[model samples]
Target: MKWKTASTLALLSAVSLIGSACSGGSGSGSGDSEEVKDASAKESKDPVELVFYSMSRDSEASFNERYGDAIRKKFPNYTIKYIQRAQGSDLPDLINAGTRIDIHWDSIGSFPSSNMVYELSYDMSDLIKKHKVDLSRFEPSLIDAMKQLGNGAIYGLPVYNERMALFYNKDLFDKLNVPYPQDGMTWTELDELAKKLNVEKDGVLYTGFSPSVNHLFLTNQYSLPLLDKSAMRPTITNEKWKQVLELQLLQPTQNPVYQKAMQANKGKILDLNQFAKDQSLAMFISSPLMPLVMKEELSKFNWDLVSEPTMPDAPGVGPQSYPGYFAITKMAKDKDAAMEVIKYLTSDEYQMECAKKGIMTSLKSEEIQKALGQESAFKGKNFGAFFYNKFPAIADKTVEESQVPILATYTKNLNKLSAGEMDINTMMRTADEEASKLLDGLKKK
Candidate 1:
């Protein structure tokens, strides 16, 4: 089938901002089962049950409905179950206790390679090569990142991908007679657009803009890992860090809309509520899942999305893509069956179904993106907006591992900076000193 290049690029861009992992780097099923069946008969036997491990109930349910059901229907011998928990919680106990976990599926960064997670190249390599499952279909950066997790071994395959974008209220834009946000807009442009939308009507305040600084600078888009992994120290004091901090600091924190909501609620964080429910927020930066979060209020106001604003220096690059990955374990009773399941999950038919449900697929196919959100209640909305920006490449392994710790420390200091307790310079310096000390201690231990 001839797929449009435009659609593929759009999905790639959207996936980047939606937390689907991607970097500036560069699927199938059926009679294929025979190849694997011949290679290994253990997985072909009946009464096989597969465990889907994850931290989100929604992801678990989605996987069951979209992937698991399809897998069962395709291979009647298998049963799929879920094991959900907090990502931080210890799971070695369950795995070591002889629990039959064939597939380890969870969001990006949720499952780090450790004693519990199995390395895939040795066990699944033969299957991958035999099936001719094209790993090149994925971007080089993504494969590189996954391989880095296990010393250049394949540990998992991405099931779905996501990225962030600017979602806006069309009603608010019309109500204020301001032009809506456009694609390819820079942060400076967005700030100006937000300024125009910041106003009041009928005593209800409308916030022009309220993108979280932590999200834009410290977490998602335009964020780099703040630790120097080789040196075991924080790079929080870098000028780029200061630039990010200053960019947000220069903006208005509480637009009239947010302030009004806060006053009405009294000491509560109503920013998200304002954006999603109250319809007071003009624009917010978030994932395409925003539609799902605001399903109850679907028709309350007309909304649309645009690519997240980009940094001037980093034109076109939005954020790193973060998505859930599915890996087969070496300890599975039916390694062949697990490989088959992985193949099915990343297949075009299955991934297209995912797109129809408003979920993002990591498969780099325009046909998949064209099918995305087609059957969703959000159908006819600006799904293309999700793909407006380019995805940034994930950094090296050391930086990737230290992201959480560095972000954690910077988050605290960011709070102080926002609250006026510390100046930008002071905040950056303090975050650097404290994070360096913290990482140094961790390295020693």
Candidate 2:
């Protein structure tokens, strides 16, 4: 995909001169070799536009403000292009239109469905070695997840990470005279706390806790596999899966107060909005992006975070790492330059900046973790909760796992379970059967 641009022409000339000088020609001095190396480095940073594509639907202006500006400042010669999904520039659309995407970015869970499915993933192992990129600098789980997704090949570098945390409304807890949630609390203890805070006050039914079910399932601490790849079937009816459902969903909704609240709200899940805006939720288990996403509403309330509640079996282990990665695509016009850009994005300097902005860093650096949210308006908040717990190992997602719409089936059964129409065992069995049917349909297709 290389273009015959002026920089390429100059690079070719530099290579020829360096080869001539190395062959015992005139001007074969060490100084000449150093000059040639410097010239090559400069040419590598020459003016080349890279188009970034993601299904995130972030606006160009937002991307520029968050990352594009820093990238441009770092490599002034390079042009940055962001293809917004909102502009109908999806991977399929770009491919059909012959658009050359240099980089593809998305959460690790999405790579199988998006980049790999479209055959846009480019193995960056050779480039990673060539650039001397230190994979050890990042959280091992993030790197391990990338390799797992690529079947032992490095296809991407993690730029940032997110994880589930227990965000509690300080005001609601104070009103109920309940002590705050402490880090390392087990799910059983958290459930008791939720029960304490689930009372009605001043005509408003304040719920104790609500987890983002999708996030919980995606980052299940049990490292449960949704699909049994060998048999190419859903694995939702396993004992571990049953335990997760009992702990996360059925047991929580079994509370009469929570169930009444759900019925009152017309079966709507008590989500982030209830915690941030309505102020009726006492605690929420969600991503650390909450403060950034609900800046204004969150500013009006008194909230703090603790480590995500753990299972009794997995004491200190939190959810799996949910990281966003930047990968060089197969369609990149200049793979070397693309590699350099992604490497910079994962470097200590940029990662620290991201942390200061309240974005979780993918790096394992203690200094970076300490600096998190320092530059943000909520600097005084409990940023430590983001890294307080150990991340569980990531489970490998199979091809069938990505192809089957099993999560939808789970969500449907969860609704039934929430309304007390089905028991936990029945819900699991129904979800498994439905998911298997969906998988069968896909196989037939």
Candidate 3:
């Protein structure tokens, strides 16, 4: 999940209910996206081109195959060039090239701290209204979600926000002799299963658990704020923060992946796929997108998804990074044209179309629900947590403001602790202290 797609990996898979939950099942989706644009749009005399940039993440090909050529077919007046940013700094370089870079991807969270972007992005409220776009068609929770981003402007919007749910390998569950759990499984139960499944082998140990933890969601699970609004500094030493760290510490012996390998073998990177691919690991706590990774890597192994265990057998409000909307760029030379693109993309027709691609659609329209509800493989399971979920997730306002470096440093140490280099208490204290210092530094700057 880029910034929006980004956090689904962090909170949902690892914890119970950290993102917005969208319920889907009944709706109409347009099978064909033939442009229903005005005759004026079709009869335009001159050809206009829109140069756009995409993060071009792994899922791009599927999106392009469905969305790209069809969009061109619908809007023939505009020639669209997509620059895939496969590596670093292509955005600024491209903008410098005067490519008319009309549309670009901006993770609002990354925009503020970068300084290079504020001057470039367009304010889209007017464009949104002028196009008679139906902002109400989206999930209502997202309105405030935008407020948490760069200066509270709708600089960029996501087609759909991402929410995470736990993804467990059913084959691993069978191998470990553990049973799948229901949505409200207690942490104690999850840990008990982890204890049984985790095996220590030649210098390494791998098991069914790990937190793709980040401060915004993980810390917040215990009700900790990234910074105290009044104090404006890292306040992880508080009760909420303590609880957050304690949850991760509870499973001292488990690693997210590599159940068959041990620390003596020195596996530094214990990722979600370990359980999915390595088979050494039995379960992965991650976002819905984990399936995409699993589908590609562990084709032979049968797998399933489960939701994160709720705290004390109660549903927890979490999972960060719900996908957002697609807004018109202020820098857009043709605001009307850009809004049309966004309108169409966010419309019921387009979103429902996107649903068939295995990527969940955030549209509140009937079509989106029907598509998702019908996706049996991606939906809930018997005795397993709901695989694809929508929950109230924390948006990364901190990261968007360049405060992510603060959390990044903290998470790195947290990972180290999971690897058994340090005790949880020591890691927590150290991270809390250092994060506070970083926050202070940011304020001074």
Candidate 4:
């Protein structure tokens, strides 16, 4: 799992202070003390090399071009050295290898363990107060999510957040003679719209909706947990989870579009390109990244995006989550220097630059929003849809190793449910029982 790569280092030149201590009698002692003090001050003032480990594989050249230039201009005394590591690689092993990584930058989904990161609550609270860092500048959801992940102990600051939105093909809606899905509509309402769009015409099957089931659970707009942490058991047998699965699981068996695609594609799920470039899907829910990926094919089809469909039960809450977070590692050589780097990266100037470069900003400012996607391939699209959703309280992360097996069991049960071999109750109960066994086995080991 190792992908170790190092980028060329950039040195910042600083003038070194020279001192002399006269060598004779009592005056020499005082001169020696003064010389020592001057040396210490000079050492403190000397340029420091701050090693930054970014999880993303942006090469040193691109990093410098996009962000390093701004960073270097702001902190001339500290040189930023980009230390590269592949995502999901062994972070502790890299630390043990004596790599001087001062700051850690990674997506929220790929965050390193607490054993690797320094608990920043005490240190950052002081720095935040001393620097008068405006906590209000960042979105409350971003801050709250970080706090929740750390169990009220802040270990990181969010760099950027992402929200799920519903993208629809305008051409498909027009062809189907159905109105476009509106913002703030419930998922139930979306289901009806999807049914209307599921029509067969001219040898082409149009999919009304093809949302990712995994996304619904991961995003968990309803704050549902697959595993009950306290009891250390699976909770898929619950009514809430049953409804969640029924929403997407039954679609494949019930929807003509999914059935036809599965038959034609040899049992595989619907092809994403069918939805993106082919304009066969009337509506789909996904992150903002989709539009960026389909930017070239977008203009070929008339399409737009809206807020993620609301939860019918909950009404207006949306699942908002931060994608990237920056933290100072426990093994950092210069903690204060790392904090300064984080501060600079999250500052208004840096954020504005990021916004102009089409990088999403974690800061909550009208100016930044207006500037977002300015340089992106989706420059003129509905970038405003990103903010329409409200952030729900983040649920605790499931950390058990058995999560892999649990998800497998759930997938297997989904097949059984689809084949009519098991009812919803049987599907959930069997899945939960198998997941509980896996968890129990892991605990014993």
Per-candidate TM-score against the hidden true structure: 0.81, 0.89, 0.76, 0.79
Tell me, by TM-score, which candidate is best.
2
Provide the lDDT at 276 for model 4. 73
TM-score attained by model 2: 0.89
lDDT of 4 by residue, 35-92 (tens): 5434333443558788776645555665565546656665667787875455543455
lDDT of each: 0.61, 0.75, 0.51, 0.60
Instruction: For candidate 4, give the lDDT of residue 178.
Output: 97
Candidates 1 and 3: which is better by lDDT? Answer: 1
Give the Å shift of residue 122 in candidate 4. 9.1
Off-target runs (Cα >4 Å) in candidate 4 are: 1-46, 55-58, 86-89, 112-123, 248-253, 356-358, 401-422
Candidate 2 or 4, higher TM-score? 2
Candidate order, lDDT descending: 2, 1, 4, 3
Q: How would you encode candidate 1's per-residue C-alpha lDDT over 1-445 as one tens digit per residue?
A: 1112212222222332232111110024422455554543444456777776543333455445545556666666778787655444335656556665667665445446332233322335577776556787664556665666556667677777777777888988998999999988887888878878767678877777765544644334554655664675677777776666555444544355545544565534334567767788788776666565446665678988888777778888776666667777776666767777777666666676667777766766777776667887779877876666766665444423433465566766554455455688887777788777776676566
Residue-wise C-alpha lDDT for candidate 3, range 31-73, written one tens digit per residue: 2223433423553334766656543342444434544555565
